[model samples]
Target: MSSHEKLSAAANDRKARLAQLKSLKRKQAPTSDEADAAPSPPAHQAEISDAIVRTEEEGEAPSVATTYLSGRNYDPTTRNVKLGFDNLPIADPTNTLEYKAQQLALETKAQQEAENKEDNGLDLFKLQPKKPNWDLKRDLEQKMKSLDVQTENAIAKLVRERVEAQKVIRQKKPADGEGEEVGMEGSELVEAMHLKEQEEARDRRRDEEDEDGIYRAKVRIGTAFTLALHEAISDRGPCDILESVNIRSNPSVRSKTRWKSVARAWI
Candidate 1:
């Protein structure tokens, strides 16, 4: 036989075999009428329905439901439906996803509230240039005390120098042509002291009139005047009415005089 004839004959044989196989399968399998006449078991029926649904899903011509309704009563509720999340809003009756979303919202609100609270935003305790209150107070007090001591020492040195100057004037002889110099120096010293007192009094009165309401110049000036008087007495022997007034006002002068007298006696 020619190659073309053999090929045509093989094709015809394949078609015949396929047709026989299909006929044999049709004869063995139950048809829709036979299925209606004899009821199938519940499990077998469910399996058959599942297989039909699977086959319909794979077919090109789609069907919403591929179940045979002729054998049993048709149930509209049993037909398959096309469900997609493309159009419908997402929702779950179980409350799992909604609960999670609500929980996240609550967490975000809590964070916002915490951030809005004043205490959470600023840390008052960690301020710049941090120092303990007690330590700062202690350091300031020490500085003030040191400054006070330094000021007192400077004032005392000035008083001692003045006293030395007065003593030198008193020791000089009048015949040496120094009498005029001594009188001038004493007058100037006394005048300066009087002017200082008057200026201090004016300052005190001015302080009272000032809006700041701070007053201290009076006590300071009086203390300085008293120190000057004491130094003068030590240098000039406290012989005049002024010296008597100073001794009356500052009775501590008597103890200083007694201590000086004892030292002189011992020497």
Candidate 2:
């Protein structure tokens, strides 16, 4: 081969070897940096989740102590402890003279206010002089006089009506010996008497019919029996005959008669 061609071949071989070495270095590089650049772990995630577990066998976290101190820091003038005042071992702290003085001032102010309120309420009850007004007694007396006059008028009207009613009654009353004469005339008074007599006659006929119907019903009932006797004697009629007589033989017929008698008395 020619020298130039051989030199070109040598250079090509060196370039190919250099390229292979570069490729090998890239493949062999550590992957940790790339992984770290990709993304970081979230802060809220546990650092050693599966490895560490909370258990009762381990000691608990310390309890936080509560305090009731009011100041930002300790005051040497007050001789207050550096620790929180709420944590100080004192009971009934209000027993201090300053606290008692404040309480007494509040109570005194409340009492003064209560006294002022009571005084104001009393002022409301104080009687002020009434104005010279119209005389109520005189006005009432005048009204009473007027009412008496009205009452007298009302009574007079009522008396007049009663007198008129009594006159009408006297006029309408029949004289002792004039009853038969009044009935003999063919006037309205006689017609009224004739109507009254007709009503009374109708009532008497109804009573007689009722009595006859009662007697006939009783006789019918007695005839149903074979031994009982029934007899009815009325002032205006003859006696009813009992065809059969069974009630006399029945002992319960006496009790029935007593019940009927009681019912009639009640009616």
Prediction 1 TM-score vs. true: 0.19
lDDT tens per residue, model 2, 123-214: 65677854232265467678889898997798679667756765565577766635543444336446666887998799779767766787
Runs in model 1 with CA error above 4 Å? 1-152, 162-175, 211-267
What TM-score goes with each of the models?
0.19, 0.17
lDDT of 1 by residue, 58-105 (tens): 763213243333324334465533354337464665467777898999
Give the CA lDDT, 0 to 100, for residue 16 in model 2: 72
Pairs of colliding residues, candidate 2? 225-246, 226-245, 226-246, 227-245, 227-246, 228-245, 228-246, 228-248
